[model samples]
Target chain A: MLNLRPCTLTWLVLVSLTLMALAIGQAGLAGWGILALLLVSTFVKTWLVAEYFMGLRRVALRWRLIMAAYLVLVLSGIALAWWLAARAAA
Target chain B: MIWIFIYAELLVFGILFLAYAFARSRNVVLFNASQLELNRTAGAVNTLVLITSSYFVVRAVAAIRADRAEACARWLLAAVGLGGVFVVVKLSEFAAKSAAGIGLSTNTFYMFYWSMTFFHFMHVLLGMVILLAVWWKARQGAYSASEHTGVETGASYWHMVDLVWIILFPLVYVMR
Candidate 1:
């Protein structure tokens, strides 16, 4: 919190790198491993954006918990998507 | 809370993005050939603009909190201006691609490209609308040292859009 400014910029830079990696890795990497990597990196970038850049850091506990709850639903959606992808592959 | 909400929104988009990539992975040749037609420069410039806009909006929030409405408005306008540039550049790029015969029906790659960008473009448009509304509110002195969540919240949405673009740009423009 004391160093919010730099932290936000650093978060931005991390997203940039991950974006480039996803972009480049798309053609070169294959199978479930690469896809998993992309998902985790994307999650990290989104987390930073939500925490630092969006000013959610100052909100109360309930709101934070609500956000976490929403994230659980999101994770559920992702799991469903992965299942669908597997079904498609089959 | 707002940031967390933004993350939640991102998770939804992230799933969609994974879906797109997964689809693309299954059609390597078609997507690859289709991706070649994109104008990389447009994507790159848009990335720079959005990041700069995020920084300006951050300043806007700071300015409003400090009771500097005039400075806040200026930064707000700067953010909005970059957003406008983003739309104009995106449309023109789309037009150029269309002229080259790349439309939604072009291929799976283009379907994803157009769909993703058009969807993201709507978000950008929404951000611009919110910024204008905030500017109007600022002009009316609706925000100040203690009650400027409007600007802060708007900035949050704007930053999230830029973050999406950071990933979308490289994914659609460069990865192939």
Candidate 2:
């Protein structure tokens, strides 16, 4: 991450998670939990990779703002999904 | 050029991850079972291989910039060598799993085990291609300190591969 293109790595991780979810979704709740955990893992990985690989810290203010906004959208979506699921279960 | 492209690549992967998450939420047991299909020892070795390759690429770029073509080539070869080990181990693992009746159709877990790994294996192949291209470029004096952007970019991407493997080793094989 301290080196170059982290987004590339993030993409790889994301693909891995996606495949895992697709392949394992037929299993049950444990599968769901694992998938959720894997997504969260990918989210963190993507952030770190973007920051370190893309040098977002060193980039211009506008680009940084864009990146930050994108991340917020991601986290918010995740929160919303979990919240909705909980509410439904309740 | 490389940076922006890499970023776009991440976006593609990011969407895929989101899709996977949504799918998993609909079913959890299969995912856990699939995770078990992963071999711990192989994952560890692959992680080590990626880390070693990343180090070699870093050193290779540095050496090339210093006009030490032989050293640069040597490091590049080392990286390629380790990457080769990774591929071989991965394929053999596939064979072992199949012999164990753990084929892709065995369960949800096996499907993921194969899909994710095969996808990753393709990337490793791409990385090796990049290394080969760089090797030729270096031999022809195409990269010096100021003109080694290709090598630098490739190395950076290579390290990201290592990082992914590090996270994956723990997440898929260990955490369960």
Candidate 3:
């Protein structure tokens, strides 16, 4: 029953994702493609934390959307910044 | 009140993150090189530690909801124990950097690195305090299944601390 809990499941996924991100970092991969993948992974991890660990899933829709917007806006800003840097280097 | 604080905290961190991204963009080469000097393993381990502590908090909440005061206190204690691990690991990491002669003024990357992470470190300390207070109350059997707002509030705050690190780890240590 402990293993079947939602929080337990969420923790497992979060750990696996953290390891995946660590591996990506250690791989020394570069370029926009790797960055995009990392950002996507980040988005997923943050969303999981918000939805499950934070218990936003049981809250009002507006609250969940607010969290979503925060993630999107910040990640988009990062992606855009990196994209501009890449373009400038090119 | 906790929700408002969470929103305000998130806003502050978001600005710092965006500022970091902007600064990194301006000097991508230097940022990338400086990032390579950071101990990614430490950052990753801290991530796991925080996440696990968060899980412990979730269990604490569950225990309280089930009217298990002793179990709730035990879980919160476990969470705080992990928080101690984070502080020790982070301090060692900082000490190692200091030993290598790194300071806030070392470079743009180090500046952001020191400022942002130290800021997050303070929050972790505060979150641990909040958890301890809630834990104390739980130990006294002050929170019941019908009235456990304190536990929930503290859990929320702890989760926010973890949430910030989820972004910070990737942005600072990994996403070079």
Candidate 4:
């Protein structure tokens, strides 16, 4: 029988996401589109770490939202910074 | 208390990351060029190493939850071993850069690269130490199914370390 726990499953997803990000980097593609994908991948991976690995999934709602907000704020800030830079360049 | 510490640590890293992004925006060309010089393979591999270590830590927690102290200790040891691998790989990366005459003063990108990564590297070392302490207690059968707060606390801290790297890898090495 093949049984997998939540942590094991989370690890599998995390590894897959890491590999995907690596592929994106190696492809040498650049644009807002590519950046978006990378940022999204990052968002998912970090969220997984927070939820599954950190055991925040069973925590109080306030704590979980705090982590969620941290991810959103940081990632959105990154996106904004890049957008501003791109606009300035153009 | 650990959660409070975790939040504080997250805040610190969050500021550093925002600073990096802001600086990159001001000098996208320089940042992009310098990023290209980084060994993405090494960064990717380190990402794998840390993530695997986090998985091991998770296993350690699970083992303790089952009242399996020996298994928990062994799992923590495994995680710590992987942490050593991370240290070795990172040292080699730093050594390679040093051999190339790179330092914090190399440029703006390098300054951030060295400072941020070295800072995180220290945290990895601390996390290893913390895990080792927890493993020692576990080996003595200190944790039980009903009371394994120490294991969870240490595991939480280690996961925080891994979480930061998950962001760092893409932010520094992969994203341009």
Candidate 5:
């Protein structure tokens, strides 16, 4: 049940690309929204890589949680910095 | 042990990411302006290349698990070929940046850019070496469905490299 088909991984890659393009294209539209979108997209893409491509899906739940938390910690720091910088600029 | 190494590598990069955020917060305007000078398209392309290569690696592992030694070698070779493309594309991107007089001392952002990406570039080279070794062993029929830890170990390391780039691309390129 934890199998990640190659086709599924390919689709995830394309979805990530689309998210990247959207984030880039809409960067100037709304600063906070763009930052949030980019960070969320980053977290999602990373989860896909870890769970599917890296075969973490077949591993224990604890390991998956650790990976998820690590990603969140890093991205949250970045999102905070982005928000702070925006506030300072404003 | 490989998992330990992977986690350690992730920890190092995580610290760097935090440091980047701290630095960027101090000089938001300069960071944003310097980020503009980057070639997002190149960054995005590298992202695609690495992700596709990672997929190729998954296929290689799958081939080995299915006891297809020749197919496994072919998949690993293809992955290495794509990794070569990543090297070329990254080098070109770096050359273009250098041509514009950018370096580690250029600014805070460029400093992080050069350090993080070059660090990752080295890892890519190392991953390719591991994959090459796996490919050689695979060619010699060294792995079977029940005895493919070598392939799994190498694939795991390569995926770590891919995972880093997945976050690095948007964090550095598109998240301005």
Candidate 6:
């Protein structure tokens, strides 16, 4: 049941490349907005990898939920650290 | 279960990523300045390469599901070839940094960068080994559409390596 459709896999690849482009475009900009955007892209790409490429797409819903929550926790930790750093510098 | 090991690996990398964030928070200026010196283009290219390899890996697994052993082996080999590309790109990036006299002791930021990426680099190597073994077995008709768990297991680990890099690229290279 781990048969991911070809179209879906191709679409995920395109989405990831587009996200990379967005990150590169915003790399030199200095602002919370840019930072948040990069972090969100990381989140989305991570989820796509976990769900599709890792063949977790049709697993038990609980497993999917757990991975999603763990992802949120990790990204949120990084984001919170960045926010705190910015505030301290301010 | 391989799935358990996969999740465990994710948890480990998650902690390391947070540790990086915590370190960055302490000296934001140092982290930002050091980040400016990294080879972002190489990092980006490696990201694309890893994701492409993951796609190839998916194709390999799909091939096995369809009972196409030779096609599956070919796809796995293709993924391994992409992994080689990632190694070349990453080594060049590392060599460039070293040519400038950068090392683990260069700064706190570089320390994290070197150690974390190197750790992930090791995983990539290990994943390729697993893939090579899988490819050999696959070519020998060791698996079929109904019993290709070996292919799935190898692909799972490779994807885990790819997944870590996906989060790592933006977190370390692009985010400010």
Q: What fnat does each of the candidate structures reach?
A: 0.13, 0.00, 0.81, 0.78, 0.56, 0.58
TM-score of chain B of 2: 0.85
lDDT (Cα, tens digit) per residue for candidate 3, span A1-90: 255888888899899989988998888777778888889988998899888888999888988888999999999999999988887888
Residue B38 lDDT (model 2): 64
Instruction: List DockQ, one per candidate, in order.
Output: 0.18, 0.09, 0.84, 0.85, 0.55, 0.54
Evaluation by TM-score, superior candidate among 4 and 6 = 4
Docking quality (DockQ) of candidate 3? 0.84
List ranges where model 2 is wrong by over 4 Å: A1-90
Every candidate's chain B TM-score: 0.94, 0.85, 0.99, 0.98, 0.98, 0.98
> What's the TM-score of each model vs. the native?
0.75, 0.67, 0.98, 0.98, 0.93, 0.93
Per-residue alpha-carbon lDDT of candidate 6 for residues A1-90, written as tens digits (9 for 90 to 100):
768575366546645664665456445775777767777777777788887777688788877887898899999999899888878888
* Candidate 6 per-residue lDDT over residues B27-107, each given as its tens digit: 888998888888787888888888888888888998999999999999999999999999999999889999999999999
In candidate 6 the C-alpha lDDT for residue A49 amounts to 81
Candidate 1 clashes between residue pairs 3 or more apart in a chain or in different chains: none
Select the stronger candidate by lDDT from 5 and 6.
Answer: 6
Off by over 4 Å in 6: A1-27
Clashing pairs in 3: none
Q: Which residue pairs in model 6 clash with each other?
A: none
DockQ: the better of candidates 2 and 6? 6
Model 5 has a DockQ score of 0.55
- The count of backbone overlaps in candidate 4 is 0
lDDT (Cα, 0-100) at B31 in candidate 4: 97
C-alpha lDDT of candidate 4 relative to the true structure = 0.93
Tens-place lDDT per residue, model 3, B81-124, is: 99999999999999999999999999999999999999999999
Candidate 3 residue runs with Cα over 4 Å from true position: A1-3
TM-score for predicted model 5 compared with the true structure: 0.93
lDDT of candidate 1 over B31-115, digit per residue (tens):
6677666766677778767767777887888899899998999999998999999999999998998888888887777888988
Instruction: Pull out the clashing pairs in model 4.
Output: none
Candidate closest to the true structure, highest lDDT: 3
Which segments of candidate 4 are over 4 A away from where they belong? none
lDDT digits (tens) for residues A12-86 of candidate 2: 554455445434432423434663675565456545544554345666777667656655555455445544445
